[model samples]
Target: MNLIAKLLPAIALTAGLSAAQAEGDALHGKQLYAVRCAICHSLDYNGVGPTHKNLIGRRAGSVQGYAYSPALKNSDVVWGEANLKQWLSEPEKFIPGQKMFIAIPDARDRADIVAYLLQAGAQQPSKTP
Candidate 1:
């Protein structure tokens, strides 16, 4: 085989790894969600928990049709990066009796999720802008 043929496998492997790392490095939050969250929460629909589509910058307990735990419904906190980070780090600790499960252990992962959520939510609005 030619030199190009000898290098093809290495080239393909490098390209595949780059793409995998790109997807894995980002959406740290999404990975956390899929493992620790998606069982209950979703980006579009409330599973056992609330849908997270526009959770960022949105009012607490204001998803129209979704029923929120009283603790969450009465929560005065607005959904933003800082609050989300704290809340996800320790759901029950953030608000005793919160319906959410245990907080994510990794702070950076939680922040990534929050960033991803904000970005996801911005999709439609940015289109208009």
Candidate 2:
């Protein structure tokens, strides 16, 4: 192999590794959920807010007992990354008279939280033997 041919394989390998790293460590939103969101939202049980065990890809107002605001309950918006982003940016703006109080100031943080929620939602429960 010529010098360029030998170097090409190395370059491709480096790029592939970088892409995989990005996917693996790209759970930025989890940090936001831990610090900013855990106070209100719980993963398996209802805290001040409802549980988020499977928030993403679920229907709005679908959780069994928690009473959502009329504005939120009436809407047909599906819970996903895009809707979560908007809701995090400004809860009041997204649904007037909603109970959530804080606004997410950073867009990147919101994106990270969304990614974390989705990943967490997808996890299967481990059985204890």
Question: What is residue 50's positional error in candidate 1, in angstroms?
Answer: 0.9
lDDT for model 1, please: 0.73
Model 1: per-residue Cα lDDT over 1-114, one tens digit each: 799999999999999977755433346756666787778877778777878776767887777788788888888888886788788778888877778766767655766676
The C-alpha lDDT values of all candidates are 0.73, 0.77
Task: For residues 18-110, write the lDDT of model 2, one tens digit per residue.
Answer: 775444333556766788989888889877788887776777767788888777788788888788889989988887877788988877677
* Lowest lDDT 10-residue stretch of candidate 2: 20-29
- Candidate 1 worst ten-residue window by lDDT: 120-129
Task: In angstroms, give how far residue 79 of model 1 lies from its true place.
Answer: 0.3
Runs with alpha carbons beyond 4 Å of true place in candidate 2: 1-26, 123-129
What would the TM-scores of all predictions be? 0.68, 0.73
Candidate 2 vs. true structure, TM-score: 0.73
